[model samples]
Target: MSRRARWLAGACASTVAVGLLVTGGALATPPQEDSDRSARTEVAVGAYLHYGSPGVERMRELSRWLGGTELRAGHTYLPGDTWSNIEGAPDSLRSWARWRKAKADRLFVLNVPMLEHNEAGVPDGRVAELIGSGAEGEYDHHFRRLAERLVALGVPDTVIVLGWEMNGFNYTHRCRPDPENWQRYWRRIVAAMRSVEGQRFRFDFAPNRGGDAIAWTRCYPGDDVVDIIGMDSYDQPPGSTFREQVTQPYGLQHQVDFAKAHHKLISYPEWGLFRNGDNPDYMRRMLVWIAEHKPLYHSITDYCPHGVWQCTKNPRSARVFRELLSAK
Candidate 1:
């Protein structure tokens, strides 16, 4: 009907293509190799399989169970019962080192308690006293020794979740008693750890989900000393829904916002079913949440009341876990 208009349109399209080719436009299609690499790197997942060398082997087993879901993170806890044990106890380090060295992209996450007898129900008054003392650098040498030990063990590039869940009442390091001293102690520990030679560690300031003893925001030690903002989320409160977990103040959405505001990456070092026992809805919702957010890494606490593979109490949730996380 209009040949002249069609001809003009074709000419303009040809000119644009020529200009793009001449300018090396970024809109040009990317290589298939780069896209494939992206698909492989999107999900970095793991779980708390065990606390020692057994955990190293358990990762492989868990992977097999998940139809070969690759586990890039190895999570563990340094015993809070004694100082020597907390100094990177060799019983587990050697194996974990071997596992980490086997793969260049693998990660090692360690939950480090700030003080001995971390869960021994030390009174708030005493906790305040110890936290104040730590702020004054009285316990600096202990962290320095631990840092040195991590370096010696050949796993210096670790993600240290130091004094995690500080906003909760379960740990003696809880920030309610004295938030200022707690923050100072956190900074001191980070300084001592960073002072170690050959160390490439990342510090995660992780707090329990929800406002437990106090608002976790009050305990932040500043961005200069913190690398990742992490949360240990669990399905809880018997009847609460995941919607509440997202919309509530100081909740999951708040965590993402907080991390964005601070210009830091977010992580879920620990998450799974808790008080709402054997709930598959919680499992499905959590998996969707993590996929949407795309955190640096996440490890579910795979033990009783919160676990799937290790604990047989949540079979429906276990199926959801395998289905979503499976590489197959």
Candidate 2:
């Protein structure tokens, strides 16, 4: 799209007036879609880490468990996969990217590590290292290198999610407590990567379910900087019934609405059900609801290191997850 078309399309697509009212006494007429209006928020499917060698066997099982249907969609993950083999980091990421591009019909996401995190050897006190004294220069170079590699692999700019959950307190990379440094580092990363790949890769910024509100209010890096707005959400733990999980979609909607408000696309870059893996029948229902209601969620990443550590330990939960990923 040309610069002018991109501008017009974004403006029209976002301005979905709730109920346009006229003083001329006419009925509340809805705004019309102009020629430039875009219907771009369609759901895409995929696993999180589909490329697995012996070094990444567990992740491979997670992806294969998701099955062929899921793999054909795409996958996303940060560089540090539990610090197991940091030496294979670049090659691992590249291997996964190559698998998704070659095997999947739609390679939806390629997540890059953006912030300093405990997983990446950044100590908690290193928040100060973000933008002070040129410490971020090294991080900037890393991101630039990854962006270049992805573009070279035939992944579009939009398919890349630069950072995954910035505000959640759980992950080591979560930048919630350091908003200013996070914002500064983010701007530099975006600028540097764009210089290398241009618009071929659509930059995505994902925050935890409610993290978007905090990140957006603190900074406005311009709509051009972000192509898709993303949220990472999951269902209630295993003790609950399928109906309980059904209600969880509403929380996901909050993320979608927030994205719509900003004229950006929404995606569930990460999501899965816990403890429920044993009930394939009910789990299938949950997947259907996820696909039907969370239409804006372009990718569903059911695979993560945490899934092994936290979710799939129980045999029943593993069954539920298999049903979900294998849902046809």
Candidate 3:
């Protein structure tokens, strides 16, 4: 059976951490001009919102509350969902991008899932069939179309996080059980999207932190096709202190080392409090770590159970988040 299917049949422990630690002290400001590509850190803050109801207004409110611009929107798009309805026109992803752009020159970290959202029940043979043999044509067609649509919608520079967290055993796109096909699939998608005329999109290869299910590096599709190495880290697997989290094998330090070796920028497309909730020290340590290591961008998943906004769940952590993010 596929990993996702087995996961659906039974519950398993959560084992992912996606925090991007900033190097040095304080968040570095971006260079004045686009051409000034100096060796400096630029940390962009953002969040994943609950769809439809709160909308971008909540993000704006959070920005005001935090005293900074939430410049990136960490949005996810499953295969058959709104943003990636490959069968339909690009209205959904386009409208969402336009909404985000209307707020600011915002960067969209779009998590594009390879499999359909309801794939948890899918048999392993069917999953393999979908990803293998002649599937490149479908991937190329939809991905190029999506790229063209994003360019048309004024978001040509969108960061496409394809099949994120593939190392985890729970997702339909898990790299294990078939790493060769997974890597090939990633390369094909990248090639298809890049082939679009005037497309300047960046592809991010992100996986959950730690060697929980599989070593993420085993699925590395090469630095040539990947622009950023991202991790979806949170305070997971419980009881590990912040220091232990980063120092663990296939942890933050390993991710950083891998990115440095490949000459790529690091990113945390998703992160927040989890497993052990309401831990303000985790919040403080994470912010300090981000300020010290200096990642390209990171976003907190703000919603019930894992959210910091609304304050009902994690008030202390929320306060710490605001204070640290507001600092100059």
The TM-scores of all predictions, comma-separated, are 0.87, 0.62, 0.81
- Whole-model Cα lDDT per candidate? 0.79, 0.48, 0.66
Query: Listing every candidate in turn, what is its Cα RMSD in Å to the true structure after a full C-alpha superposition?
Result: 15.1, 11.6, 7.4
1 against 2, candidate with superior TM-score: 1
In order of listing, the candidates' clash counts read 0, 12, 13
For lDDT, candidate 1 versus 3, the one ahead is 1
Residue 300 of model 1 has an lDDT of 88
* Tens-digit lDDT string for candidate 3 (167-209): 8766666777577787888888888888888888888899988
Which regions of candidate 3 deviate over 4 angstroms? 1-41, 51-54, 68-92, 99-105, 134-138
Please report, as a residue range, the 10-residue window in candidate 3 with the lowest summed lDDT: 9-18
Candidate 1 lDDT score relative to the true structure: 0.79
Q: What is the lDDT of residue 218 in candidate 3?
A: 94
The positional error of residue 9 in candidate 1, measured at the CA in angstroms, is 70
Q: How accurate locally is residue 215 in candidate 2, as Cα lDDT from 0 to 100?
A: 46
